[model samples]
Target: MRTGGKLAWGFILLLGIVHWDFWLWSDRTLVFGFMPVGLFYQVCISIAAAIGWALVIKFAWPKDVERWADEGRDGGGEA
Candidate 1:
């Protein structure tokens, strides 16, 4: 795989790690006196997830899919 593919896979793994709930016990702590620490952490993870998805789309989108799209656009879909 290419570097971008590796990065995209690593980011996906990180997202899985983020939801493991190891910080569930830290809920008693408040961040900025508004939301619980666990919730805040999850929110940060959400943001990271969004960024990761964008990176995957930008860098790791499959070449085969693109080729198929182009073929269809060129009226090569009869087969």
Candidate 2:
């Protein structure tokens, strides 16, 4: 795999590991006195995951898959 692919997979693995939030299990702090710290942290994680996936799509997208899709769009594939 290429460097970007490796980094994207590494980011995915990191997100998987971080999603457990075990370190926040005992925390009771609240943010803006409304959202719990853990909840806020998870929200941040969600945002990060969104941005990470966007980056993966932008930088690590599969050219072959895209080409196949384009072929179908251009009616170059078996009809």
Candidate 3:
């Protein structure tokens, strides 16, 4: 596995850990006086997920897939 693969796996594990709902935050505790603490935490998780996906796409996307796409675009013939 390459660096990207390791990063992807690490990010996945982080998400799994965040999804555990064992926090002691009370329901009455609100973030920004509107969103509940749990909701705020989930929102943060979502943002992290989006960023993680971007990183994975940039660094972890299969090189073979990119090569295949280029080959198809070039029609497998000399320029």
Candidate 4:
């Protein structure tokens, strides 16, 4: 899959897991929070941050993996 798709799926899975934890457990502080906002909200914010980071990296540093593969095919030393 493309980077964007992978990121979207990752975010969805993370959110789902967080949601499950928030609903299934009463004491979420140990896993998801240490502040006033509560565990679920804290984890939502964290997921947002991760999405932002993924976007930045995906858009800012996109490269062709095949280029690296081609370079390695010749040998391991600089020409």
Candidate 5:
């Protein structure tokens, strides 16, 4: 894999690790005086995960497989 792909995968791994939020589990603080800190952290994590998946699709997805899948879709014979 390329360096950019590796970095993207690393970011996804970091997101996975941080999603646990063990430190925030017992916190009683409220964010913006409304949402709980833990809930806010989880919401941020959810957004990060969506962005991370998009990055993985852009960077880590196999180009050759993509080509293979598209080969037969253009009215071609054997893919």
Candidate 6:
């Protein structure tokens, strides 16, 4: 994959890892306590992280992904 695509994928994976429910489980009590702090804060953080990573990939490595895709197409030519 191109650099940008790889970066974007990495960021997406990271977002998934960060927002995994396992981490949130520990804070569930706080989340359901009606304080609206723990869950809300985590949601905000996850959203911000996703947006930031997406922007980084969109701007930093777009060409790399395109090149990688082109290479794949060339290598997969039909017989």
Using TM-score, give the best candidate's number: 5
lDDT of the structure predicted as candidate 6: 0.66
Give per-residue CA lDDT, model 4, range 5-58, as digits (tens): 677667656665665445444543444334434555656768776875676566
Root-mean-square deviation of every model: 3.7, 3.4, 4.6, 9.9, 3.7, 6.5
lDDT of 2 at 37: 95
> Please, what are the lDDT tens digits per residue for candidate 5 over residues 1-79?
8887898899999998999999988998999999999999999999998998888888888879878876758666664
Put down candidate 6 lDDT per residue, 3-46, tens digits, no spaces: 76667677767776776556556564555567555577678767
Q: What TM-score does structure 6 among the candidates reach?
A: 0.41
Task: Order the candidates by lDDT, highest first.
Answer: 5, 2, 1, 3, 6, 4
Q: Which 10 residues in a row give candidate 4 its minimum summed lDDT?
A: 27-36
Ranking by TM-score: 5, 2, 1, 3, 6, 4
* Best candidate according to lDDT: 5
What C-alpha lDDT, on a 0 to 100 scale, does residue 46 get in candidate 2? 93
As for candidate 3, its clashing pairs are none
Local distance difference test scores for all models: 0.82, 0.85, 0.78, 0.61, 0.89, 0.66
The number of residue pairs in model 1 that clash at the backbone is 0
- Model 3 reaches what TM-score against the true structure? 0.69
Model 2 regions lying over 4 Å from their true place: 69-79
- In model 3, which range of ten residues has the least summed lDDT? 19-28
Which segments of model 5 are wrong by more than 4 Å?
70-79
lDDT of 2 at 65: 85
Residues 1-79 of candidate 2 have per-residue lDDT tens digits of 6888778878978998999999999898999999999999999989989978987877788769866766648556577
lDDT, model 1: 0.82
* TM-scores of the models, in the order given: 0.74, 0.77, 0.69, 0.32, 0.79, 0.41
